[model samples]
Target chain A: MIDTQSSSGSKLVWVFFLLLFFAHQDFWLWSDDSLVLGFLPMGLAYHALFSVACSCLWAFACFRSWPEKLEQWADEAVDPDDNRSAS
Target chain B: MSDFTFLASAGEPVSRTPLYVLLVYMGLLLALGVLSSRFFRGTSKDYFVASQSIGSFMLLMSVFGTTMTGFALVGSSGKAFSQGIGTYGLMASWSGLIHSAVFFAIGIKLWSFGKKYGYVTQIQFFRDRFDSKQLGYLLFPILVLLIIPYLLVGLISVMKVVQPITSGMFPDTFALPDKVLPNGKSIPHPLSGGVPGWLSGLVVSTVVLFYVFFGGVRSAVWANTFQTVVFMITGIVAFYMIADKLGGVASAADVVKNHAPEKLIREGSIGDWHFFSYLLIPLSVGMFPHLFQHWLTAKNAKSFRLTVIAHPICIAIVWVPCILIGIWAAGLYAAGDLRIPPLPGGGPNANAALATMVRTLVENPLLSGLLMSGILAAIMSSLDSQFVCLGTMFTNDVVVAAMGKDKYSDRQLIFLSRAFIVGIVLVSYFMALYLQGSSVFSLGVWCFSGFAALFPLVFAAVYWKRASLGGAVGCILATLFSWCYFFYQDIFLDAGAGHGEYLVQGVMPVTFVFLASSAGMILGSLLTEPPSRETLKKFFPTLS
Candidate 1:
């Protein structure tokens, strides 16, 4: 697991997420109905691409901040008698 | 009710295509329910959350399916039909990001706590966190109230779906008369003869309840995986077939450009604040009681990797086709290829827009039946999960917790959950019949807003050590009050039906509700005593 204490990657992942959120507010293309590749509306096409970019950044977030500590705690604190679903 | 015999009298040959497709679809799910039950571990935990052993692929499918309900498929298209192409950008893109974000930030932590504490439902977590059973009891009714509308949504969508897709599938049988609204206008029955609403509704409700009752969470997961795949394929195939029927995707776009250019743009229909507020709707997934239960089913923390990474892409795949299909419907109306949409006092039955387009474009009965089954897949995927989750909450949070866990055997606990599931389904089924032919998709949004409004309670519970029991209660009451107040204004004071849009300062009610909830959370925490150190230490490891 990546170090949560000083991981710039964690911060960057969130920064990218914030950027994506802001980019999602596409006021510039609000009135523009022009098609991308002669099919997708410019707004719809932009958001479609935005969705892809979100996938990439979230993948990074997962790899960077996978919450190893939280999982570790759960593992350590798990009830000994749990035998829950045989994890 | 009068049977038109319109199509059959006009010499349209009747086929049993939709009947067969529906039977196969319903039968498949029932069989799955039986199959899953056979392997059941015969314990409460295993029944409720699949013993928390679901792996990555299963988690992805079940989570995606449970989240992508009738709203994503039916409501988005219907909303897109009414508003514009901006509908996709309005909700889908935000969902792609925000939903996964919530899943990452919120779901994993809850799963950790669940695994550690042997908690099964969200209420257990809240009760433990705030050290207040009162808070848990209060949140329970509110969540139940919010979830009921969604059940109505699934039921109403089926009521809408069956008639249109199966309009000419019979020889002047089961045809309904135009439903007379309180307003002067009426919705002409789709055809003279077709499948009856009660029969279809009963079949769907029975199928979903059967599976959930037998296999509980595991059955819901197994079915959701199958249904998610089915609907995704449905979207693409429907897009291809409808586009090809209209020439091509480009040609369809050209048709819209030439005829209903307004639908292609956002300015005339959607404003920036209005568009931005739609993001709040996606946040409801963060608070969905059903989705919380699904998260607990993950085999491990790492099982979420596929879900978080691939969710946005999955949303894009389903939503794009549904939204595009809607805009193309506008093109159909513009070119006079389709009739003027029948407007109730509020708006056209946008719910029918997608189904109507399918029938108008596709000629083959077999193909139409298959496509319609895909819509059923989308609806029932969430329905089964919601049914089981309410049961889980009743068993773990309400009954078992109050009665003392040691008092009841595992079999009795499972039985209580199953009994509750049947009750809710029956209640929702009756509600569906009571509110037939109403604007279901719009009411579904209100439910989303209600859930979205309470999201901060869960957020602060997870993130903030200073959060008090009072704060959690205050946050929930604020959500309830603000929601009820706005709902009152939008429905009674403002006149519910005609305009059909509910907004405060050009933004959805959800925006104001969310802000109000956050404010309540902060103020209540400040005014009241801080949570105990032991409680904080349990959740926030850094404090320890």
Candidate 2:
């Protein structure tokens, strides 16, 4: 996450990756575990695996983009004058 | 003739081209034109809402088509097939109720706002409420992202069913049709590939889009009336057919209870968590931009409420046929009385099983044609509105606003909207090409969750005195964050690939995110102080 010196707020983009990581880990569990009520279609099972894999990559993208979103949010919140002379 | 010849002859007589069916479809369209003539006028208001002159009866029928589509017809029936009577128990029924309740609670507020401001589209409300064109601009892209996939799925499914029925009209020479199957009953062998499926999808799409392009929402409403009738009649026919096959309702219920008890009884057999998670789906329906757009189109508060009251009964009736048949289908397939062909690899096409059920019950060529039309009607009724809304969002909110500076005239904007509809259809078609995951039901749920997250903010914006702009922004972003997380985990990570694991086990993490967002909105607005009394009074002049 990008550092916003003014308020030190965490960027919103990080949330996406965090969710994605968990989702992927969940898929792996679904695949390896024995579902007690596993009456689902085999196609559903296959697609579940596919969704998990795709999410992992999206999470990576979110991680990389966090700094940018943070910078943008900070820029929106603060005026340039406060930092101009200080810098 | 020998016994073999007799059997062969029987099969041959049962199959016939879908010629008269195409003519019937055309006649239905012409009738729609005549019925809608007096209702149609030149202005946008006339097109969008019939000048808010619609009565409760018409409003009720049209709204039915607004939400029910191929998914409900195909997917819900499939669920009933596998799950039994219990699927319609508390879980599904409550979700349906929540959807209605949210509409009444949130919908009345929206309709009131629309009445106050004469709002036309989803973007119009966001733009005015936030006091920022920027918010409308921001939302336009998101609406497109959500709506187009929905339109593509509806159109493709409709075409998939309608194609064989209309093949006789188009003929092999006209559309480069191939004779892969000896008749429509058998699946086509590996094509010495002929005209692409997309080509057929495009042809059907163009026809639906034409009315929406020329007539806009008015066309959608009129067409919806016919489509809704078709949906209900066919649904009833389907239910009766299935019920009869099962030895009437009482005997059929007994067979289902004994043979497919798991499905017949809704005793949390599917697991408590799974049943509960399903709640978010119908709840999300009222919040979808297109659905709300319909709400705003209502003539008065009384009509709106009456329409809401009628929908559940209509839906309950429509759902019965699909569910009962699904139950019967599971039993038949399991007992070796029926065979459901598997997809190329090994899995069942549970989605197509409903269509297969229809193909089984009706032997007459004409009746089969009518059944096919009912399915297509279900699909197209939903698709048209989706396209109209999708294209309108892209043109009105995104392209025109982004271009800025007296960018286009009203006529130009309307034309642009139509072009975007076609563009959206193409993009969604491509996406469908890549999709091999999730049944229509599951996919529909996933889509609903995202929009459901947005409902509360809008509700507060209209009704709460202290709903500050700051609160709206915060709520919107928070909901967005929670939605992305839930879908990412539920779909891609948990359902798609072996990449991530769920952090919070059930729908709670997602639900909590929404709750937190709502709380933030309430607190944020309360702390910030209300907008200037003058600003409020100007926007809401009726407030004494």
Candidate 3:
């Protein structure tokens, strides 16, 4: 985990997230007929790569920026009598 | 092959392979349901939410599976055939980003609250959070209304795709006619005695209902996991086999280029406005009732991490193949090597295009049946979840909320939920029959658009401390009115073009409706008294 509590780390994560969002709009490649490998269309191939890149960004965020505080609070505050009706 | 007549009686089969593959797949799902019930804790909560015992991988597969409906596979392929490659860009790519993003943000938060509050349905959560029974009543009808179109498409896709798979299984019952395309190519014909479209649909709905009746979301999760793996693997296998049948991927590309070159370009097919507006459509998943139920089943917050990370990749694996195969179908048809069932104005019935391609190109009936089952798996996976969710909402939100949860025994609750599900299955079955001949891709956009428009209500209820009771109600009303107006104009009033071609100046109505929804949320909340601090503290505990 990359010290997500740090201000710099949070900022860098946001930058990465925004970049991935914008990069999804690949207008320049819309009409490009060039195939990525031997067959995939340029626009289609670019999107495939962009989707993979988003997976990595999410992986990073999940690992580094996991919301530990929310879990701790919920765990602490959950009353034993709070509708525990199992069968 | 395309025209369906109700089979009068069962008959001997020319090829039993396809029907056997379908039976085996359905049996496996039923078996999974039976097996999952052994682990059921025998509580309504356990049935509905799986006792929040589901781990990260199960949660990931189940959520991804529930989200990947026939809309993603059959409908996307259909649109890709009718429209072009932009279909992938418009939905699959954008959904990969937006759906997972919503999971990471909204899903985890809702799961936390649900785990804390003992909530079973989205309506239950909001009913408490907003402290309004009236809001719950209002939401119940609208949510069900949105879900109807979504369910209709699944029924439509299953019925549409089933005819081709069992084409020659019954060669003696009904008279078969050869359909010929305008290009002089003979379309595939259905042999006389195959399973009718009605029986095929009944089998699907019955299997789903049986599994759901047994283990509820636990079965849905298990079946979704099995279904997800089956579809993705078979989807890729079908992809390669079809590409090879077309003489490799490059040869396939050349065919499209020679015939429908515009399909390869987004500017040529789907414009920027429509493409970008689809971002709003995936937001609808944030509010999907089945997905909300799936989120509550997560064992912990950590369960969501896998779902958030892996969802996009899973989407790409399934959609890229389906979209490409559709483009290839257009190519093959134009090259005079293949024929698809025709539309009214002489276009391919795009919704059935994916299955048609699989059956036509991949020659082995066993392989063809397995691939068809894989697509069926993809479609059926969501069918159970959606059906179970409607049951959950009706039971937890309408019945239990109105007649206190304490009034009913756990057995009675389970019985009631199952009864409601059976009724919904029957009603939806009849409604689907009534609404046949509509386009799956077009209807899917409108349905997703409605939920996408109303979804933010739950978001505000979860995240915003100031989102008032009135705001919740206002948001629901505005989204309902706006969605109705847009759907009417697009579907009934203006019969201009297909789904993506025309929608509020190249933009989908979801955009304007979403803006209307947001405006309702903002103005409605500001105009009303703020929420009680007790409610705020309960939901947003870290309110420093």
Candidate 4:
């Protein structure tokens, strides 16, 4: 049911990895004088924003690549009849 | 020394209030362990894997708790204090994304396979996947060896945090012998009146062991959930208080800008290669034996959905506060607003950086006690899981498998597991007492690097159809050899000169070892025969 091999899904995975690659480079925070919002160091602020972006990107990865067949398999393993009987 | 006399010491009268809070927290964990055992089914399956019935909420908390060890709190703050805001870029930012990615890629697949095949331990999976029992023989020792040092890091950190917070509580009882230096000035040791490292280490070990010995993995999951909540709340509270004490966010930023501007930026001292190398370290989570065990406890594959979605967010919530506090500590010190504590040997001790900030800034004794308990919560959460995982490995992989499946009864198997857990705790406790001065961050990095080097094996095993038994063996051997070489160079040959500094041509050693292991796996598989057709079909049913 899941289409991890689909073009869009695979592309998203590649994009996420690329984003991570650039995030660690710390290029924007290279200067000691860089400051954001009048108080935060530019580099610290960059990483803080980057962490938020990572959360969003990972959520997208889950939406695109999560395996559907595994969920179905799990449902089959836990029968509805057994639940009713236990109740 | 009378008890009344012991109660009076220098520097703001030590309070027993914090110690009471910690005792209550420990009591709550013990109660949870006892309660969970009421549902035990008296089978090896229930004892080892909770009969695979953990729901999504419990699963998420346990997995997150196990992964976020003392290093995340004590080590991260300490490192950020020394290295600046670059600490977040080095670890938390990457871990947030990579840890969840691994959960999606490896955790789901392993869970499905485990449910279908009735597999409990990682060794069982490797033994069947390669159709070679010898692979388990090779992997068992390496996995345990890597994990022991990781366990010691957690144990050592608990002692470090507790000793300083509880200092001056029992001055006379723990009094130090005064020594006259060549200058003819007699001075008492700094930690003389505090709870010694050995006693704190023993107390934490015993508390964790008590719960684990009673309830097995199920109790560990429950305990982790409780501790995770405790630490998250305390971590945020400590952050707000410290920021206020430093005279608001704007004032603190001004201090850093004027005095220690380097702590704000990274490019000047932390090279590009060093920054890039940190990305490799988080991959070690994929190959953690304890994590693998937690993954296998999922009631079904759906249990993983919440974990994958929420993991990055949870990481952000905990890490941002600790990283900010450490950075603030550096600024305060630079501006001459705070005094950094001297180590026992009389230098600025970075490991005590976070503790000193909290103790100096947060004045309310009740609040301080709660905060200390929260730090211990983060520490003890990981310790319980790691302790149980080792016990599970020793009993399942080494004992039952070697003695033949039918030789031991279920009760005997549980007994064996509990005994092994006790043995491991005692050994690690002694090691913690002996290796008192080692840096938690450096020890943690080495352990993570060794596991990260072996990540190629687990990645290939799940994805690559052509992966052979020879390749798996080669990957393990290459990782071990690289680990030993770097360790020898850093510890012995260099006389600890490169401790916590990126080595291997200015890059972290994980980068080289990861590349070497991957290449070895590829070449070895190409040189040897591919896995049999039936073996490939079993793992990759859709492709076949």
Candidate 5:
């Protein structure tokens, strides 16, 4: 279980930054002349779709890679039942 | 209604209308300040960080609003006019992802640390985490220096938009001197009889100062939320009206396809290296002191979830229209379909491209005034947060912490903060006046690069246990040195070249600066002692 969890976590981190890397790369240099929907330029349309992909990917990160310890710390700090305050 | 017919149908110059709309917006911000001040609990903590009481929605809105400055609206559009559709790829799309990722990685972590340590300012974090008080001294000035240019970008853009919108309102009172054009025909200045840039900048500065001086961060948050809604709604409306005026979206795209097809494609002139390096600029958000202050205001780590998820969507809402408008302007100018406004010296002005397009395309005075106010909303949303953050930094980091926290009372701290805010506002306002005609996009990129170069320090400080005080200090000095060298080369030596130019071997200056700062940190830490074990445990308590 530990092995699977750690592997998945590392994989998620790699995938996140990899997506960012590809998003930043200007692959549209080749398809510069193409238009999407007969109105939007190919490059502009790619980025527009890329932005939605980013939103989805980040939402996944929030769900998967969110630090468990930090959540516990926040709960402990803000929760009235907890004996220790934040500071 | 044909395009040229609207020029003939131009009604009485509604120069005063934009100003009145802007005044009403300013009045709303002031009222919010006064109202939020009633909830002030008479504590410096409440005044500076709002007692860490900001919830998810307000936190998300304020962060989004603070990031979506006039740069996102006016700067993006202006740059798109010159650069093409790649403008979205250059900043906005990447920023949506990078900024949210930073908020998740850095912002939430900082919020957790701030709450655990009772820290208010970013300097406080560095000073404690690194176990070096001197680090604060080095950081306070550099952060403030970098931020001032960002502040100037906001001020300059406000003046740029307002000047054009309010032109011709005071023709009798303020007639501009006529100058001979390149074609040997004399034409009056476009903004000759309107509110001058200096006056517009001062008015904006004064309005921002009033609220930040009164309610501090709380008021800035409330005002940002209100402004965010105003700009987002009006931005969409402006985009629709402009598209309709240009004979619909399909027709507008057809115009570009026929006249300026190069704009639709990523021009070969923009090298791959320059395009890729534009990605590094968004990393600057990780180190923005204003963003740091906002991060510290989150009620808990969970509050950041909304910001991380919703922020990209908010960025898209604000950016797409601006980018499209700018690209559309290029096509319209090329086809001679629109009467493109000339600059003061009588050439096509890219800086005022968006305002010119809007004013020319939209015939309704009421709609134009609303659109102008929406642009102002975007500008002022950023100015308030920056104003309050500087004041908070000075009071918490410089005055109280340096002088000893016990040396001043809560009331005295608030008083000092307000005084410093007014002083900085005055300095920025004057600087804006002197630096008139600077491109908002270029100025904004320079400022962001400076901050992005310093990202190594914060990233290491938070994540690496071995990151030492010397390392933090070293990174800062390295960043400042490279920042100055590149800024000098780009501004003075290059004769005001655009971002497409390379610093060395087709690489951006940010590439070198980021590397140097990272190298400085790693080398400085290794050469010196590692951070004490106790210090590491404090920041990384979960680790054994």
Candidate 6:
């Protein structure tokens, strides 16, 4: 289980880097004219920045929440009746 | 279409058919298929999922290879061609990545259950999860129905692209009977004439079917590894060659900025909501039977995880060339340097776009033949996977489910699986000849939507403790209801304004159906009592 999580964690890191590449591409959507609002200003750099922020937040959230879920699952495994307070 | 125009349009006339190269490629694929058939002396499990012993690398390759279908290459190129540089932005590029993410997030749990219960089909897993025999039976046909069109679409797209090239080279031998287009022009059928469409379809399908039949998950894995490498390199190379002809990758931006700005930008007329919905279309991919089957075949959690991670990166490489060349083609056409001959049927004219680009860029016949083979490889990779998935599901899930599990031997099941594979190919070939669809990409998207509608019930069955039998059944019914409604409203209803557009906004009816299923799963489970502990133990022994 530890090895699985570690490998999955490293994968998340690789994904983070790849997302960085997509962002660098300034991947345009449609065209500047079509984005009438121009509020978000679409470009690869912007996307890269946003993706980085999102990935980081996701990682943090996963780190914080995964253990609790794991503990709950483990508890259920030990005794399915114990966690009868089913969702 | 006559050979006279084709010869006249060429930059330079060359007699070489690149026959050796073509023979080499065809020989290699056939050899792989025939050689792998020897491994069929095993159980159905070995044939279907390779006894769950697939490695990470093979899994990764198969995932990438199968997903980047011929239509993905040509149809995506057509999209890039017609949409300009920005179509990639509109593309469900992140679908592969997100699907992988979903698998990691929820798939590990499902895999554990699969290991515990020995679940063979996705339908079987759902049956155990919901504890509803009725729901299992209800879903069996729906899953099969939804899967067939997706398979049909892949087969048609491959035939559309590969047939033309094959006919161009071996006109007398491989070309089929001529058909009169809607515009009243006669052109040779790529899959039908000398070899006959049914025969060629059967032959091609047989190659893929035979491999998957005997090789099962193992052969598919190994063959996919070879095919994926070829697909990725060929895609990158094709794009590079096109870009070099234009100038370079750096020059692509300049070319688009100056010549095809409209193509580069999305038009407001299409509506932002409709465009945004394109993003949601990919969600359905995660729910595809074939993809789920691949996930089920994973040897371990690590293989599954690695597959999810590496799959997306390969997607980026596969698409980069297609998108780049598409932009180049748009620029060339816009510059009045190329004339896209009118297609058999008058629509958005995407079919001729990629072919035109290949004609303009390629000079050497041998290189052109290799490049053509690359495209065919892309098509076969996707078609093979689709047929294999369809055949396996039909035999294992529907046929064997009705017949008691103990009644059939492993060899009998394997034989049935191969037979079904061939049967489906013939149906799809006939369907493709008369079927009127926009492009392979569009067909794929429509298929994804159909599958996505049911994903909620499916996902809940794996993860939700309260996903009841009633809920699973309701979910399947709701999805089908929404699917029929969408087909009637979006497709059948004569709202004909845009070019064969069926979806509304980014939200499809399937989404609503999925929501209904989610409600069913929650309410149905709560209203009824849970299954017995013994039943739960039998269903999910490895949960702990």
Q: Chain B TM-score for each model?
A: 0.94, 0.83, 0.94, 0.95, 0.96, 0.87
> lDDT of each structure?
0.83, 0.57, 0.81, 0.80, 0.81, 0.60
lDDT of 4 at B470: 89
Candidate numbers sorted by TM-score from highest down:
5, 1, 3, 4, 6, 2
lDDT of 6: 0.60
As for lDDT, the candidate ahead, 2 or 5, is 5
Give the Å shift of residue B403 in candidate 5: 1.2
What total of clashing residue pairs does each candidate reach? 1, 28, 3, 0, 0, 12
Cα lDDT of model 4 by residue, B231-284, tens digit? 999999998887777677777667776767788878566777888888888899
Which docking class does model 4 fall in? acceptable
* lDDT for residue B380 in candidate 6, whole number 0-100: 71
B36-110, model 6: which lDDT tens digit per residue?
767644888877777777778888787767777755777777777776544554453445435555665556566
lDDT of 2 by residue, B422-493 (tens): 787667766665563345655665566566666667777666656776777777777777767777766666
Candidate 5 chain B weakest ten by summed lDDT: B1-10
Q: Could you give candidate 5's per-residue lDDT for residues B1-544 as a string of tens digits?
A: 2242333212255546666766787788778888988988889998889999999999998999999898999899888887788888878888877888788778888887778777888888888888877788889999999999999999999888877667677877766776577778975666666678888888888888887788889989988988889899999999999889878887878777777778787766466877788788999999998888898888878888888888878888888888888888888777776544566555667778788777777767778888988888899999999999999999988887678878999999999999999899989988999887887888898899999999989899888888998889889999999989988988888834554444566767888999889999999988899987667666776621
lDDT per residue as tens, model 3, B1-544: 1111122222334566887988998998888889999998899989899998999898988988888888888888888877777888788888888888888778888888787777889887787778778788888998998998888888878888887657667675644666566789864453345566677788999999999999988999999999999998999999998888778888888888877677777776777877778889899998889899999999988888889999999999998988888887777666666556556666667777887787667778898889889988988888899998998999888888788868999999999999999999999888877776788888888889998998779778876788998898789899999988988887788644644454787788899999999989989999999987666656666521
TM (chain A), candidate 2: 0.32
What value of lDDT does candidate 4 attain over all alpha carbons?
Answer: 0.80
Give the DockQ (2 decimals) of all models: 0.42, 0.02, 0.40, 0.28, 0.36, 0.12
**Segments of candidate 2 deviating more than 4 angstroms:** A1-87, B1-14, B17-23, B30-40, B90-92, B159-200, B399-408, B436-438, B494-504, B508-513, B523-530, B538-544
Deviation in angstroms for B120 in model 1? 0.5
- In terms of TM-score, which candidate is stronger, 3 or 5? 5
RMSD of 6: 6.4
